[model samples]
Target: MTPDDDELTFGVEEEFFLVDAAGELVPRGPEVVDGTTERDGELQRELISSQVETATPVCRTSAALLDGLTSLRDDLARGAAARGLRLLASGTPVLPGSGHEITRKPRYHRMAEQFGAIARSSATCGCHVHVGVADRETAVRVSNHTRAWLPVLLAITANSPIDGGTVTGYRSWRHVLWSRWPSAGPPPMFVSLEHYENSVAAMLRSGAMMDRAMLYWDVRLSDKQPTLEFRIGDVAASAEEATLAAVLIRGLVRLALRDVAADRAPVSTPDEVLRANLWRAARDGLGGSCLHPESGELVPIWTVVDELVANLREPLGASGDLDFALDVLSRLRSTGGGADRQLAAYRRRERLTDVVDEQCV
Candidate 1:
């Protein structure tokens, strides 16, 4: 990929649940990942043995991102099949076993030791998008501005309606589960990069988390990279959906940076209100209402979604992702997103296995 001053690059990381031929969750992450290394560090183990994660290479455009994601999914599927398992991209496993097996990594063991049952119950998968920036200050500034829009992002990508063999009554049950962690959720606006770093350091000093990497806010500056990462989305049901989420997030970052450069103050929503907005989004998805950050009035989720896209229109067009964003948003509005489709499947067949199987394809 050639450099373009106007264009910012991004990457996607997706986590998947591994299941057997019978559509039962399988603790086979180690078995499947023991000798596999197509993307080396990009493909990694998660806390739970039933989960595997794959990261796309840095992509300069939406098309490149879609291509990389497609290849990664196919490669992972093929590898899992050879190991007598199937990879399901849904956020929560439909038939997760009651007992959990922790991966034998030191960090994972420590997490299990600390969080116990909560750690064991986390069989959720998600899509994390990282947008590259010029420097840490820019990343921090962009992240601060992006917080208000995160609920809309969650509503659009909600896919975890069912968990542990029962419907959780929340479109993004994964979000609900992850929120139990003290550090997870929308972060507070940072006054500066120093302030952000200091806040994380304080958390670390308090043993809230083992390290900076554990600061799992909905949007955060990357601890190890010069990028802003969005961790609000579930692992999308398809490669196209994943690509769409990544592009919109990159658009958000680009637009936020532009606002920052203009010396504009970011629109702020109080943390209490933001948390409530997140819960509403997770509960209803596009089927419900979302709080408009500006008005603080509840509006149709579709209206909020469209407004978000409109807000990023200029930046998206500048980054060559406007068309893709519009197309995906249109499709989502028309056919509904993963949670809608998953619920439809369950409603049609009245079976959780059917829902899981539908997502596997």
Candidate 2:
């Protein structure tokens, strides 16, 4: 694609866990992924004996995304249901004392040894949104711009508010769990592709990452693709919610691209302010203030959200998903964001089973 390409494409990768009807975690049996042949006798990317992942083919527009994701999710659910398996989308382990067996593959085993104890204990699932970028400059701008919005995505999609089968008193405990890796936290602003590459090279040199793809920033250029990938969101409970996220990412990329075209800097803010708002968002979600990315002031999250929607109003309207985006916001507002729902489930039923059940539902 040329640098001026306006065509925005998308790919979604959802990591999931295989659960039972009784809402319990089942350790994936050995050769789980290898044995996961389709009923017709071929495996799509939906492999793993117990756990599985689904990737929608790269799509040209948001409308195509809805069709693709809905089809993939529905088919995967149907196939799993027929096999007496329940699929749950979340980050981190939800069942206490459940042993999450890592797939015994050379690559996975290598990752386990490379990341050490956290990798051994890590059972985190994330919803990665891949938005195609035309070049490195736009990719860098998108990465930096997307970094400031990371907390928003995290807050909204924080499905695993309770971690390790226990209430963590925060909405997205997976952030903390995911942060346990040495190089895994968030990213500083990368002003250019050279900067991002240098950081990744440094990480590799320091034994922090095996490769560039392991730079676990909220957003970054995919070493393997021509896209800026957002990896901050928890795997959502449903396809509708997942599409909402993808819509926002697509809009965000358009906005960033415009900013770069005009030589406009990202609405700048301090590192500490970003971190503070991030922690606050992790604790309270959309209900509290998100520090102004440029001002470092405690601004209401909804206020920021409204401003973002306004900035992308034209693109969002053009995509014809404005109504769906508004509906998603309404759901978050009325029923609560992920953290709110998780906490409420625990409070009403006094059990983590209720929380996990909500996850599978």
RMSD to the hidden true structure, all candidates: 2.0, 3.0
Using all chains and alpha carbons, the TM-scores for the candidates as numbered come to: 0.96, 0.90
What is the lDDT, from 0 to 100, of the residue 295 in candidate 1?
94
Which portions of model 1 show Cα errors greater than 4 Å? 1-4, 37-41
- The clash count for each model shown is 0, 1
39-147: candidate 1 lDDT, tens digit per residue: 4226788899988899888888888889888887887888898888888988998885642589889998998888778888888899999988858877777877889
Best by lDDT: 1
Give the least accurate 10-residue stretch of model 2, judged by summed lDDT.
Answer: 39-48
Score residue 234 of candidate 2 by CA lDDT: 81
Error of 2 at 191 (Å): 3.0
User: Alpha carbon lDDT of residue 8, candidate 2?
Assistant: 75
Question: How does candidate 2 fare on TM-score?
Answer: 0.90
Model 1 weakest lDDT span, ten residues long:
1-10
Q: What is the lDDT of residue 288 in candidate 2?
A: 76
